[model samples]
Target: MTPPVYTTGQVVVNSGSPISFTATDASGGNRTAVFTGLTLNAGPNTIRVRGSSNSSNTTPFFQNYITVARASSTSVVSGTTTTPPTQTTISSPYTNSAVLAGGFAEGSLSDLLAMAPFVPSTNQFGSWAYGNSAKTVTNDTITIGWHKGLGGSLTILKDGSGPNLINNNASITTTYQGQTRRENGRQSDWAGYGTPFGYNQNGGGDPYTAYSPILNAQQRDSGIGYNWVAGGSISQDTSRILHYETRTINWDGGLRQVTYFKTQPMQWELRGVVDSTYRHVFYWLKGREVKVMFIIQTFRTDGQQKFRGRLQEGPFMYITAPHYRYFVYTGTNPTGETGTTGLTQINLSSPCEGAGTAGCPNQNDTGNWTSTGNWIGALDESNNGVFIVTPYNSNFVGKQFQSRSGDENSNASAYITAGPHLQNIDLPGTNFLASASYYVGSLTSFRTWYNSAGIVKMPFSFSFTPGKTNGWWSENVSGKLNSDNRYEINIGGNGGQGRFYSPEGSWMANTIDTIYVRGRFYGASSMTMNLQWKRPGETEIQIAQFNNKTFTVQGDGVERTYAVRMNGVTNWSGMIAFVKLTNPYPYGSFTGNEKFIPTYIGKTNPN
Candidate 1:
């Protein structure tokens, strides 16, 4: 039996040592005592061993014991014990602290979104191939569309009419809207709007022979005009006009495309077909993150291997990174208000505007909006909400891209710029990838989730909910980073109770009641439990009463509500209730010493 070299528990003696023991090993070998002196705690006669350790640091070798009075003799024996009224363990479905309940909520929502930096502007150019000549024309009218999940089907008409098809049906006129046709030297011809290449608008049994033309895919916003430029030739053989149409079907509660067609007719045929109409709009989901990806081949037609275009010339997805409901907390601009330039690391900031603030800054500087980095963030001035973002793919080098409000970049829209773009492609047939992720929540919660997930460096708080281990234990215990990213916790621990004070013996006080804790806890466990009122040079008090109950979480990853009220105790360290778990294995494993994580402690219930 190896002797225990270390001990964990609160101890204070008026005269003699509180703990006196012999150190030994399994092989009958004696080990030197390196144990430090302990400062005895006052008032509490009940003493429970929190943890114990051997020199070898073997698992399952530690145990918890209690100092119970023995009526038979003056000496007392160490044994298992239970001390407490009742402790109810609440199970939460929220796997990450960064996840929010309803994301964000408005006071009275008419056309309200619970979260902000709402869905991005349409990506009308996502699924289609890029080409020099536009090929998506409906009856000579240019059209583009994408399937929206649960929202509705979206089809835009480029002939200047807004989206013609929405919610799987036509909301606007389907008739062909007229658009100007630019000619080089040849006379223009006008033909009635026709259906797509193989469709017969007159309900005829015979349809035109099906054919497709090879179109050069061009970047959508790569400084190119949405019109056909004259090549200075009037000859029919020298001019080529492309047409496009979409065929769709009802799929999985959403619209799915059966096929998209692009066709060009010989100019000399003069069969009388109108120039293609134009539409530009993309798909977006409400209160959800946006992701866009497409494969781009660098080689041009006629077998040009290397891309001869400018390094900055490429079709990139345009999006807004809104800070409408959030404010920059950490990693902000030189002014410390909102992030005006692209950054590699940023915190969502604070002020998660539940509904919204009157005048919030939600734009970025146009000049450095497309800055390159791995992370970015925005703030919600309305309620101190934060919006953190990260690029999930390597090919996507742009992470902090955003749009400026009231600037020429966003056309004066209050949209923040965000999304993947093909900025520097000089290689041939190189596959460019774009991907990103986002988290919206309060500043403290965002930090906890971000640090625990090991995504990026930013302000972070520790989370102690039970469930699968998230690997944040090291940083949480070490206190490497802080909530404001301004200071750090340099004090080390015995790997047991959480240290709230700095190494200089300064305590950080938390006043929020109805706190939520998630971590492994056993019987007879005691720690400072205070909701408010922490005075200088005062020992924190423990909960006097505990309540046990069961609850069902509404949605996975959504915050729930819980109330902690003192049942039958007087001034028990300002504690309301004690929640404990019998089997802590479900949430995570513990070595009998690590402190519990107070996942969240607040006065307001997020639910």
Candidate 2:
């Protein structure tokens, strides 16, 4: 069982030195924490300390890691010489019964993110995503604040220094975990309750604080809170703000690690529970390319063994995953893993992650997806997955457009559209308040349902009248366009902001896949978004042509009226679309293979 290497060493200044040290503990006493660079060498040193359980105790440490070999002063010249054995010492400390008042340093994590600042309310208008200026703080230091998306109310600003910093207020909010992941519309765990998942049916706003039950045992003791409230009225930027600094709301409970707040007006969202015992990991660290989602079940029992994947990148290049299961809506369900086990009505599998499409590599439909069983309930289980979060969060406010030196922001560098014409090009810039995701697939036809593999969603401020802008949008999102509710695919166009075609707008279910789109785009003038995702010449935007495939059609003739065809291009010319369904779906669609996969998620409207 050779596995216990806790080493700490140092001390050897001055020319005369002869130090030898060796400290080893083969877990016999198992209780290791050796950290030093101050004293651990002088002549003969072998100090190993390991203790546990009401017995042998010796804990004393000043930890002054002073590892300087031989020094005759004079900066020691030549490699700053500080060589050899002049000191040797080791002490084992074990008595941390509380009182380790150290304070956020070792990897400070931006000092715990300057006290969780993703400011969501200065009295309204919060949802950030800027890169032209997010720093230079000095005036009011609340720097930036805004977020009315997904339940609002996490405002900040203690010193943004405005008309008396919002008339001298200090900002205070602390509701740890729960309401942030898998939120199903709040109720308990104390500390200001009620108002968890705001509503308009999953897109409502307003209701920042109220219903907190006095820290209700820190919500079952998951720990991670820091509320310094008071943030609003900072002026200049013209709307589209959203900031949130509320963390430790249980860090997804147990073993903590749901850390997020992606710098400045950036963004964040990482959830949990795919567990079968460690395997669900999503790390972008800082290369940026995240867009993930979780929750899948058509039939599962929870007894996982092993899944699969492939892709290697050392200092960068990471896209990992390990599970999905959504069983219980049987029309006659029955596939592999043997079946049985009873009771099931589960529903929740899309609080996705991964903004850079770690590995969806263009999947319209293939095969090979093994373990899914991890939907067990109880505790508030109103249907798990945090009661069903909008697959994590869907905040895509829009109005961003630009075109310089040519290459298309629109109006033609040949033919580049950001109007639900293909896949949302940031959707025109104005007050900017996107995050309008969609997911209600059903077209009981001759079989062939889309949106499930490498999703492509877009809906920022969708609502255009005037004969539906003469183009028509609303895969059922509403804005008056009823032809039975047309929408096969239309990313950006028609309405104000709408993309991520699932009714079947984007094509090419074949090669060159890579689909990962994270949200956040508030603009007045920071435009230039193009993601044909491949529709120009490399050839790929085919489905009506019946190539870029995506299906779900279940039993019985599959239905009919299937006339699919989609294509798009920017640097030169090409645009086309079509979508019509009469009756389809009973079950038979869900293929993305693996890895924090998500196409879109937008929420906010509890107003």
Candidate 3:
């Protein structure tokens, strides 16, 4: 018989030779077609076959294999064949290096410096060495030197002594009591000193009694003040650097390097006075114009104890920049103090009463200072200064300036009373922590650098616990941190929302292009969840919204991950002041028991 013709689309072709075919019985009453009188090639070959319902309509073709034996043999092999699988390539907008450049991990320092705006000339980004090692941690702005003799204290150096210049300004020198004084060098002992008794020596309190983690006789007699440091307390074990690392962290906007160092657990004083362990973590991040230090203190007790006392000072930092003679306060000016609203300047040139005396010039600059809106800054004649930012949380209550001048030690220095004033309180095996940040740079670049630094270092966490919202708030919706570490929300009606609003503009909207949400939904009806945001200074009253349908499951309760892209949204620009999640379904159409549990919310630049 004539060979069957094959057709594709509108084209048809006939075989060159006549062929024979037969039908055979198969499983399930199916029939198989067999063909014969076909020539074969020696190696691999591709065969194309087509089937048609009729002459007018053609069905898609599939592959079949038939291997013929040599003419001397009498057998043939027949089976269905499949093309080998093709390798697929996945493409992403971001690279692995870019994504992990500033994140917290081993070997993240080199990646951070590769993308940093300013890099240090001497990069000592590694594990810290102890003992007589001369290893130092230097960045673009400052050098944290490891004292060779003591092998514990970290001396802060700037200007001439430091590695880089602050605002391109060189260190200045001046005369003080016929002694040479430089603008920048090692200024103070890196320690915290306090006492259970009152700070006043004449008010029936111990004169040479104070508690410090790194108290020593050498630092006490340095002439800043002999009375503030206790001689009996010198032999106490000083806090040693237990661990150090250069790691990256994902802050608000992007990744940045956080040089972290944890101190060994040490008692507050010589004897087991409080019977507690005090540990500290020092975080240093170098900015383009300023060097920032975050001091974190964690307290733990072996048992219940009472720390009823009058004065508790410490985490004190003394700066002896000779040119920084004027003390400036940026906050609500104290009633009888100096300067305008939100700004005050105090001259440290002349000595106050008891200037050279022990704890003479220690005064509360801001009466009952509570808000983060205040900061204590010391400015020089050229507007270059170093300022200590107020703590963001409720650990500190007031700001005090401890200065010394008009004595044999002509250079001025100050300390912040970081601890709260204790009268009588019981800490029952309680674990608590507190933190504060410091800046060293020129006054002209303060605001821009300060705001950027705050945004980059702002804390955002969703792994919540009971009664802790993690800076999140709700409106018309009740929510709680579940046992599984998920944030569960129950919506009662339409327009119910869960929000995180920052009036001070904590998020840089322009830097973030996508918001990643991972969660599970439980509901029968279809509903639309929206991601909304607002810009504080924008004229539009309505919040910007993006519909996200990832959580709209049919009561299956399956977890899903999705992204809400903000790059195309016109209003998602500038500083974002608010962000929230809401649904617009009516009450009767959707069940009020439609529960949603969100595990994480992250912002990034996916594109």
Winning candidate number (lDDT):
3
How would you encode candidate 2's per-residue C-alpha lDDT over 507-583 as one tens digit per residue? 22232122222222322122222232222123333422332333222222222221122223222122112222211
Best TM-score goes to which candidate? Answer: 3
lDDT of 1 at 274: 13
TM-score of each: 0.23, 0.18, 0.38
The TM-score-based order of candidates, best leading, equals: 3, 1, 2
> In model 2, which runs have C-alpha deviations exceeding 4 angstroms?
1-323, 326-425, 430-607
List candidate 1 stretches off by more than 4 Å.
1-294, 297-299, 302-364, 369-373, 378-380, 383-388, 392-411, 418-428, 439-448, 454-607
Question: How many clashes show up in model 2?
Answer: 147
Instruction: Tell me model 2's lDDT, rounded to 2 decimals.
Output: 0.19
**The 10-residue segment with the lowest total lDDT in model 1:** 102-111
- lDDT for model 3, please: 0.36
**C-alpha lDDT values of all predictions:** 0.24, 0.19, 0.36
- Model 3: weakest 10-residue lDDT segment is 4-13
Residue 126 alpha-carbon offset, candidate 1, angstroms: 18
- Taking every candidate in turn, the Cα RMSD to the unseen true structure, in Å, is 33.9, 26.8, 31.0
Residue 81, candidate 3: C-alpha displacement in angstroms: 83
